[model samples]
Structures are given as structure tokens and as C-alpha cells.
Target: MIPSDDRQPPQKGLFELYLEDMINLRHPLVRMAERIDWPQCEQQFGPYWCPDNGRPGHPIRLHVGLQMFKHMQGLSDRELLDQWVENPYWQYFCGESTFQHEPPMDESTMGRFRRRIGEEGARALLRMTVELGEGTGTVAPGSFRVAVADTTVMHKAIAHPSEARLMARAHRRLVARAKAEGVTFRQTYERSLDGLLMRIGRYAHARQFRRMHKRLRKLHGYLGRVCGDVIRQKPYGQRSQALDDSLYQALYLLRQYADPKHRPKLYSLHEPEVACIAKGKARTPYEFGSKVSVITTAKEGFVLDCQALRGNPYDGHTLHEGLMRVHRHCGHLPVHTLVDRGYRGSEITPLSNVRITGKQKGKGTAHPEHQHRRNSVEPIIGHLKHEGLLDRCHLRGHDGDRIHAVLCAVGFNLRKILRRLARLFGLRFIQELLGLLRESGTQTGQSMNQVVSIPV
Candidate 1:
């Protein structure tokens, strides 16, 4: 069943005061809640729930608001839930009228919510933020016409892959599954594998390449024998489908890791979709994740769009698709897009109505201001990684990658909106204060001159 907010006033009890009565209305979160079109979001998200079914789920506002807070503050689901309990402001932001001591929902429910929404829904959330920026005047109308585009890697949460580690992990997974299925293996190699892994690490650290290679072969042999045993006992029923899938992946990795000529290697066993992206950085030469294309307004720095590219495609080739996404989401193509030298060879479709600008020097050069805006995307990408959750994604699969990138942009834009609102409120407060002082001076029957200045 679709969840709806409780509209009734809080029941009279020992303490009649409610959270809505206590929180300051001028707070940024409180004010932002009012500005956001919750009814529209509820209408859009309500269909995900069955009209008549299991226990009612949490309110759409609670789930959506919690997601906004999670990315804006860079808090994990567990951490966000804990903080929501102690902060009335957070409860109010989630459309709660009364404060509750316990968590509104379980932490695992967040993952389900993300899966239910999928990539398209995440994009809608981001689009809503862009619309919010336009409505609040933080992002000027038609600013989307002049935008900047760039690409960055959103790294996944996986350890650095090595021959020893891969073999050991495969061996452990196979053994654990065999034990769980009540299938007795010829030899588990449990004790010997542990000591072998220790020696393999020591050998690699000491630059004993030959010794490390020899031990890796032994580990691979152990994994091969265990795999054979599991396969021989195969006739797995429906219940063992997950175990069968695990064995299939282990065998696939065994083949790929053993061959040096494999075109695409597996970097992570759990996150098979993770790709190794190499952006020529001096400090970090290689990044393991998906490449993301980010588009932002040239002047206001509001994020226009964020899309995760599947393979590690060239930066130049991603432009056409990025521009198309911008058009699909915003309903208009940019008039001009500023990009770096990496996008030099790419050709934009004429139908896009977007003019791509790269670095230019002497004659036929772009205007100085337009050229300068190309570098503006650098800091925005940095904030997306540091402040947003783009640095390390915690969700699962390729869809998770796309959803994570979009949510990070959503978070970034929300933070910017909040900062703008706070600045506006501060200026209004100062003006009111000055007006009050002027009124007092007039009432005192004496001319009082005063200069009140406030830093932006």
C-alpha cells in the first residue's frame, strides 16, 4: 500500500507540544521543505507501491527526504537514520509532524527504495533539483544554454586486485559454498591455503617474483581441484542457484586471471561491472570504477546533468551522449558548451544545437571569459567527489553506479541551494534590523545616523 503522511494533530498526552510547533520556521531545511513540491513527488512515487497489499511502507517524503539528506551531508543510511532520531529539524524536513524516538524505517529499506526507483527515477530526482534551483532563482533561467561539461571517475569500493588475492578469494568462496551445501570435498586445503597466502604476500613485498609466481600457481591448483569436486557433485536444485552462480564466476575468473591476453579482466569478484579507468594523473595513475560525465551551468555552477558511462570510453566520444542526456532531461540543448582539450576530436550532432568549445590560442580563439569557464568544472568535480559521495560508491551493479552519480549531483545542488537561501535570509535580517533602528531614532525626537554593514 502507498504510504501517506498522517494529517491529524498530535494526540493530547502528558506533553502536548509537537515537533512542528518547536522547530524554527526560518531554518533552511524547514523552508526548503516548503519550497519542494512534495505533492508532485508523492504522486509520481506513489505508483511504486501496490494499492492493496502487504504492510504499508514508509511515507514517500520520508524516503525521498532521507535520500536528499544522505547525499548532501555524505552520511550513510545507518548514520542518517541515527541522526534523524535526535534532530527534530530532520524529522520536520521529512514531513513529520510529531517527533518519534525510534527510527521511522530500517536501514536496509533504503537499498530497496533505490532499487525500486532505478536509474530513471534517480534522474527525475536530479531533474527536480534543477527545477528547484530555477524556481528559487539560484540558477537563472536559460543558464542551461551556456553550460560546461567534464568527465570524472566515480571509483567503486573494491580492493586492489592481485593474482594471490583473486585466487585466495575464489578458493574461500568455493569452500564455503561446498560446506553449506553438505557436499564433502576431496581436500579443502584450508590450513595450507592460509599459510601459502601469507608467504605469497611476503614474497611479493620482498620482490621475490619467482617465488610469488610459484605460490600463486599452487593456490590456483588448489582452487581448480575444489572446483572440480563441486562440479562433479552438481545437479544443484533451484535452491542452490546462488551457489551455482558463484561457482560460475569463480571459474570465469580463474580462466581470465590465468591468461595474460584477456581483453577485459575482472577487477572485483563481487562488483563485476567495475572497470579500470586510467586518467593520466601524476599521483594516481589508475582508478577502478565507471567514468561519469558531469554537466554544469557555465556561470552559476549548478549541475545540469550527470551520467555514468559503461565502458572506459574516450572522453571525446562521450560528448554526444552527454549532450543528448542534457536535452532529454532539461528539454533543451545547450547553445554553447565549454570543455577541455580531451574533447577536441569529438563532433556534436547538428541537431543538438550545442556548440562545443575547446582550448584555443591565437586567431579564431574563443572569448577569454568563455575559455576561462572551461576550468570551472574542475572545482565542481572536486566537490562532487569530496562533499558528495562520488569518491566511493557503495551500491551494487551498473545500475547502482548510474544511480549513485545522479544522487551525488542532487546532493551537490541541494547544498548550493541551501547556502544561497541562507545568504538571502541573512541579508533580509540585516535590512529589517536597520529599519528597526531607523524607526527608533525617529521616535526618540533626534536625528541618529548609523551605518550597518553585513558581510555576504
Candidate 2:
């Protein structure tokens, strides 16, 4: 259901005026809110909802505004809501007729709203930003024809995945869940596991590899004992899905312990889908998370498309899908898809009429001006990571990863548009000030002439 709009001026209460009256209308956020096409937003996210089911949710503008606010400032749900209550501009931007003294919704409700919209809805939000950029003249229409592309790792919010830590977490999680499922065990090892894990860490830090492996083996044996106990009690066919999954994880851990080198390793017991990607960096040779590919306009570096590539695919493998997304967003394929040497040996070198740059030397000579633009994407990716939410993802699962990456892109565009608006606002203000000074000067000159004529 669509949220009702109450932004009409006539409905204002006698005691409380509208937020538009209280806050500066010239502020960028207020100007931006006016620019956004709320009807189009209702059209985009309207299909997800049934017109007659449940009470109408909050206004689509509020949800989209909150999404922009979240990424623009790199804030979590709690932080955004806490400030939303106090910031009249934020309230006004979200279509609040009057100031909000209390939070509009709980933190958990925002999470549910995000999930309800899902990945496609998130992409719609990104599309809206692109439209806003084009409408405001912040991003040029010609720049969309040529885009620079790059990939970066969006690290998950998890600790370092050491053997001892993985084993201990698996052990504790399995035992606690089993007890909840009414399974009794001998020597649960909940208390003793922490001390053993601490010791393993200390030994490893002291360069005692042999002792660390020894304790690792001991922890592995204890986990094996728990697995044996559970197996003896509950048959595989009769176990709950979660119990079965835990049992398999335990078995996988045992297999890794038996053979120190294993394939398709599980980095975190809580987040099993995470992968170890080695991007050939000295400081961060290996990052354990998903790979995100971002495509931006060559002219102004506005994010045209962003995708989270799972399975840690080769950088070359992700180009086709990313460009296709770009086409979907911009309504046409980029003529030049510029990338680094990482995408040198890609199979789809010639993406239709689009000339893939960065592999050939003569290509740079052909387009000298845009050759340097490829490297500009690095700062865009850096900004998305450091300034937005892509540095460390807190959302769960691959869906969360996709949505988060797209929202960060939207936030980056909003930041650019805000700066452009602020620049225009400042220039206008200066022009007004100069006009006032000139008018006052003319009046003073005319008055002085009259006084001089009288004295003569």
C-alpha cells in the first residue's frame, strides 16, 4: 500500500506551522526533495505492494529519503533515526509537514522495510538518483556514453578467520543450539573452550606454530566428540535443518583439521558464504568478503551501476554483467568501457560496438583524453568504501550485499548532487550581495550630487 501524502499547505494546524515554514527552503536537502519525482517512486515500488492489503506503509518518499540519509552520512539505522528526530531539515525532506519530536519508526522497522524492498527496489532508488543528477545538470547526458569500471572487496563484519577461532566458534554455537533443541551432552566444554582458544592465540602470537597446531588438534578432537555424541542420539534423517547444517560444518572442520589444506573453506561459522579473495595487494593480500564491481561516468564519476559478484569470480568475468546493468540503467551501452589491466584477458573483449579500453597500447593513443579517466574510478570506489557503507557490510546474506552496494552508489550520487546544489546556492548568494551593494552605491552617489548642487 502506498503511504498517504499530507504535504498540502491548507491542512496546517493553527498551533503548529509546517516544517517548510520553519527551515530554510534554500537548503540543498529541501531543494533536492522538491526535485525528486515522488510519483515515479510510487510507480517503481508500487508493484511490490498491494493497494488494499494492510495499513498503508510510510510514505515512499520517507523510505527513500531515509535510504539516502543513511548512506550520505555513513550512518547506521540507530544513528540516522536519532538524528532524524532532531534535524528539521531531515524531517522536512522526508515530507513531514511539522517537526518530528519522536522517531518515525524503530530501528528494526527500517531493516524490515529494506528487506521488503529487496534488491530491485534498491536499484530503483539508484535509478532515481541518476534521474535527479541528469535533471539538475550535475551529471551530463553525454558522459553516460563512456564509463570507467573497477572492482573492490566489500569486507564483511567479521573477525580474522584463524583455525583456532573458527573451531571454537563452531563448537560453542553447535553446543548452545543443540541444548536449545533438547539434546544433552557430556563435557559441553563451553567454559573450557574460551581458555583453550586464548592459549592458542597466545602461542600463535609467540611464533609457537607447533604448540598452536597441537591445541588446534585438541579442539578438533573435542568437536569430534560432540559430533559423535549428537550422531549417536539423533539420526541424520530425523535431525532439524539447523542441526544438520551444524553437524555438516563440524564434519567440514574435522576434514580441514585432518588435512590442513582444504578447498572451499568456510571463513566464518556465522557467515558461511564469505570467500577469501586475494587481490594482489601487499597490505591486504587477501580480503574475506564479496567482490563489488562499480561503473561510473568518465566525466564526473557519477556511479552508473554497482554489482556484488559472489563466488569471488575473476575481475574479467564480471565485466559483461556489470556493463549490461549499466545499459539497463542508462538506456544505452557505453561506447568505451575503460578498465585496468586486471581485465586484460577477458573473453568478451569487444562488447558489441563498445570498445573495451585499457588492454591495448594504441587504444590510449586513439583516446588520449579518456585514457587517464580510467584511474579516476579508484577514488570513486574508495569514497564508496570509506565514506559510504561498502567498507564493511553489516547486512546479512548475499541479498544484503547486493542491496548495500547499490545503496552506497546512490548515496555517492546524492553527495555529488548536494555539492553541486551548494555551489549554485553560494554563487547565487554572492550575486545577490553584490547587487545590493551596487544599488546602495548608486543611491549614495545621487544623494551626494544633489548636496553638491545645493552648496554651489
Candidate 3:
């Protein structure tokens, strides 16, 4: 059931009574907590829950705060929980009234929360961060009029694909599934598979192409035999839907591996949705994952929007949709967009006032500032990949790719806001300290110059 605000309060124990006395109320997290719109978040997220069924869910702030903390720190769910328990500042950020010895929720709870909120909810979190940036003055009111756009590959957490590895993984999955479903196979290749894979790797590394081809063919043959056995045992009519899907994927992998002309190929066995994208990098020639478009304000580094594009389309083709997403999320289209030369020849519908960088060429440009701002997004993308969670996405499927990208942007913006607030508070404290010193100097019948010379 949806928990009511009037739920009975727990009796305060001795430890709870003394908790506030031990914690620092002036911490950045505590100040940020006061600044955040918790009620708005609760209202936005509260609809995902049923009002009359299911057990009472955890507070919305706890779940939301956990997500922000997760991507902000680039931590997994387990690590977030461990750190949350030890840090009182984190607890206060989550709206906890008093410290607790136990974790707020289990590691799996984060997955459930993500699935429940889905992509739209993730975008809401991004919007909240954007709003916070504006309210905190980190991003100026007019900055939203100008946005920078760029695309980067958010690599999937999977091994680099190879012919041998693909065939071996397919064989192992088919064997494991057949055993689980009680469908007997003549030869599972259980003992020989590992050694065969090892030999294939060694052959490839040693530049022995002939031996590598032989092992790959052997592995492929083993997979096909096992697949046939499962089909014969389970048959078309009696097989479970999951078993049928597995067999289909195994067959698809076998076909793609055997042929060199398949247009779209599966790269990872577990994550079939992963795509191999080539971004023309010398060191890293190819990246295996989805392409993400990152939009940020031209002057300030706050992220405006993040969207995952499928099929690895040209960077130019994604501009129209990227602008629409910016409009949808930010409530207005940027009056001008600064992008790198990759976006040249893009079929962006011309807006009379909207200025796009690199579109016009001449000695004197319409907006030369936009061209200079284009390179700013490069470092923003780097920070999103390294400091934010956009380096490697661990969530499943295309939906996971989109949601993870948005959340990473959210984390980036929140971290910036927190730092700005910390600086603001630090300066205020210094100003107050100077005022106190001046007042003390006056009371001691000494000039401010005399007080300035006093040392510890």
C-alpha cells in the first residue's frame, strides 16, 4: 500500500535523542538537503506506487537520493549502501531525521526502483538537476538559450567480440539451458570446451590462422550438434518459450559467425542489443555499445539533455531528434547550438533565429563565439565518461542504455551544484569571520590594522 504521511511514528530511543547533537548541520550535504525540493520529488515519483496493495514502500527521498548518490560517486548499488550507512551527511541528504545502524534498502532495491521509474522518471531526475542548476545560479537564466551538442559511445561492459569467443559463448549457453530444462543432449562438450577455447586463443595470438579456423569450426560444429539435440528432444510444440528463444539466438549466432556478409551481427551473448560503433579513434578504433548524444549549456557546463541513439547512425542525422529532445526536456529550444564539424551537412530544419555552428563559412561569421564553444563539450563528455557513470553501462537492454545516460548527466549536474554551494557557503563563512575580527578589534580599542597583524 502507498504509505500515508500520518503513519505512526517510532518511539525515540536514547541514541536517537542524542543524534542531532553529534552531527554537523553546516555540512554541504545538509545545506543541499535544505535547498532540494523533496516534496516535489515525492509527488513526481509517488504515482509509480499503488495506493492500496503491496507492502509500504521506502520513502521517495531515500530511493531518489540513493540514485543521485550512486551515479555521483560512480558507485555500484552495494557500495552506495555501505557508504550511506557510514556517512551522516549522506543520511541527511536522503532526508533521514536520525542516524540508523542498518542500510536503508538492499542492493536489489535499486534495480527495482530503476525498472519502476523507467526512462521518463530518469528524465525527471535530470530535469530536477537542471532546475537546481538554475536556482543555485550555477547556470545563468540566459545560458539555456545556447546549447552544445555532441555524441559519444557509452561502452557496454562486455568482452571484445571475436569469432572464437562468440561461438564458445553460444555453445556454453545452449548447453546450460538444455540441462536446466531437462532436455538431454548426447555431447555437452563440458570438459573439452574450456581447453578448446584456450587453444583457439593461443592459436590466434601466435598468428596461426589455419589452426584458429580449425578450432572455430570445431566449436561451431559442437554448438550445432547440441542445438539439434535440444530441438529433437523438446520439439517445436512442447518447448518452453524461453527455450525456443535461446535456440533461436543460438542459431542466429551460428549463422552470423559462419557467414561474413550478415549486415547486423550480435556482439555479446548476454547483451545482444549491444552495437559495435567505430568513432575513428587511433588508439581505440571501435567501441562496443550505444551512441549517446550529450547536450550542455554553451557557457556553463550543466548538461541539458542526454539521449542514447540506436543503430549507430551518422552524427549529422541525429541533430533534429536531439534538438526535439532538448525542447521536450528543457521546455524551450536553444536559440543557438554549437557543435563540432561532424554535424556539417545535417538536415536540420532552418530556424530563422537559431544559429548552428559550422553551417556558415566566411571570414566574418554570424556567431564566432559558437565555434569556440564547440570544443567545450569535448571535456564535458570526457568528465561524463570518467567521473560520471557514462564510461561503461551495466544496465540491460536499449532502455537501460537510455536511462543510464540520463542518470549520469543528472549526477554530473548535481555534483556541480553541490560544489558551487560549498564554495558559496565557504565564502560566506570567511566574510562572517572577517566581520567578527573587525568587531573584536573595535571592542579592544585597537584599529583594524592592529587586528590584521595579530597571529596565532
**Candidate closest to the true structure, highest lDDT:** 2
Candidate 1: list runs displaced more than 4 Å: 10-14, 179-184, 233-240, 351-359, 363-368, 446-456
On the 0 to 100 scale, the lDDT of residue 59 in model 2 is 77
TM-score of model 2 relative to the true fold?
0.93
- Local error of candidate 2 at residue 361 (angstroms): 4.0
TM-score against native, each model: 0.91, 0.93, 0.91
Better of 1 and 2 by TM-score: 2
Q: Where does candidate 2 stray beyond 4 Å?
A: 7-9, 347-359, 362-367, 439-456
- What's model 2's lDDT at 283? 98
Q: In candidate 2, what are the lDDT values of residues 127-244, reduced to their tens digit?
A: 8888889998899899887788889999998898888888888888788778778789988877888889898989989999999888888898899999988888888787899988
Kindly report which residue pairs in candidate 3 clash with one another: 1-53, 1-54
